[model samples]
Target: MTKTKAAFNGKRLFIRLYCPREFKPKCVTSSVPVTRKVSNRASKRIKRLAKPMARPIRVTVRSGKWKKVSYLIKPGFRNKVSKMAGKRKRLLVVRDRIKAKKFAGRKFKGKSRTVFHKHRVVSGKAR
Candidate 1:
């Protein structure tokens, strides 16, 4: 008798936010707050609003229980995986949380930190 485990590959996909280097040079700077005793809140708000954001990146998990599935390099694989991942609401929540966190900090953390916010099964693997 022969025993064989089913072929299984698990991947995790998530979105990342960033600010393009060029955007910084083009972003408008907020005016200096009044030198008076009044609140500087308005200027702070302007500064945040003036911050620029670049298009988000869809990233696959790399080096973990779920390994990075290199679908982007394969023809048509990117679209297939994207469509599958799109149906998972958990990924959207993860994206939104990251967006809110960046907005609060007024900067892009990019891929500096590891986030394990949520997970869902996509196709046959755990994403």
Candidate 2:
């Protein structure tokens, strides 16, 4: 038999926080600590707040396997991918780590560093 559930009497609270990018541009987070009360289930849900973040994000992708990727262009570069790779992909040799991260797709779950960190290699080793 299907179990009945109680009506939720949640009090919606709109909490404000700083943009996370201020500390580290391009960094995103689920949420920051806030004073408002939230349900245990909802707390697990991760969402990027519209507001700015207070600090730079210190993140790293840990994986055993990584693809050897090079910019798909010459020294001058051509396509977006190659262009992103810069001079190394063209004339000079280029080999960068491509770590995967959490897939933004709905059908799959689990983090992969290869895809998510693709730009890092071409863009130059991230600090």
Candidate 3:
């Protein structure tokens, strides 16, 4: 699960860069450039846009060596956010059926991965 709805939308854009990954020589990344500097730039931009929202949004960036795997796992949301105020309503629908479980499984391109995260949005009381 992700902390913000914006991430679900951004995944489509990021997939075009990291999917079907390949290994290149040193000083190369994704056949383009995906360094910490580049990721930091993107995270800053996203955080700026989220400033207008009722709550803060968390934008995470995965850095380090490039791997032959997808940057995003799968989209999942909690039922609580359905009636909550925010943006990106279309992508906020709850996908995880099981409640009280923090581990989710996913199989992408014959590769299995376990995603461990809290689906519920943790925040202070609303104003």
Give the alpha-carbon lDDT of every model.
0.26, 0.22, 0.23
Top candidate when judged by TM-score against the true structure: 1
Query: How close to the true structure is residue 9 of candidate 1, measured as C-alpha lDDT?
Result: 31
Candidate 1 accuracy as TM-score: 0.17
**Model 3 — TM-score against the truth?**
0.16
Question: Considering lDDT, which of the candidate structures 2 and 3 is the better prediction for this target?
Answer: 3
Angstrom error of the Cα, residue 17, model 2: value is: 1.8
- Tell me the deviation in Å of residue 124 in model 3: 23
- For candidate 3, the C-alpha RMSD (Å) to the true structure equals 16.5
> Residue 13 CA error for candidate 1 (Å)?
8.4
TM-score (all chains, Cα) for each model: 0.17, 0.16, 0.16
Residue 36 Cα positional deviation in candidate 2, in Å, after optimal superposition: 11
lDDT per residue for candidate 2 within 11-124, as digits (tens), equals 111121122111222222233211123332343443222111122222332333221211112222223222323344422111111222233322222322211111111332
Q: Which ten residues in a row have the lowest lDDT in candidate 1?
A: 1-10
Error of model 2, residue 42, in angstroms = 23
Best by lDDT: 1
Question: Model 3, range 77-96, lDDT digits (tens) per residue?
Answer: 22323333243323222111
Model 1 scores a C-alpha lDDT of 0.26
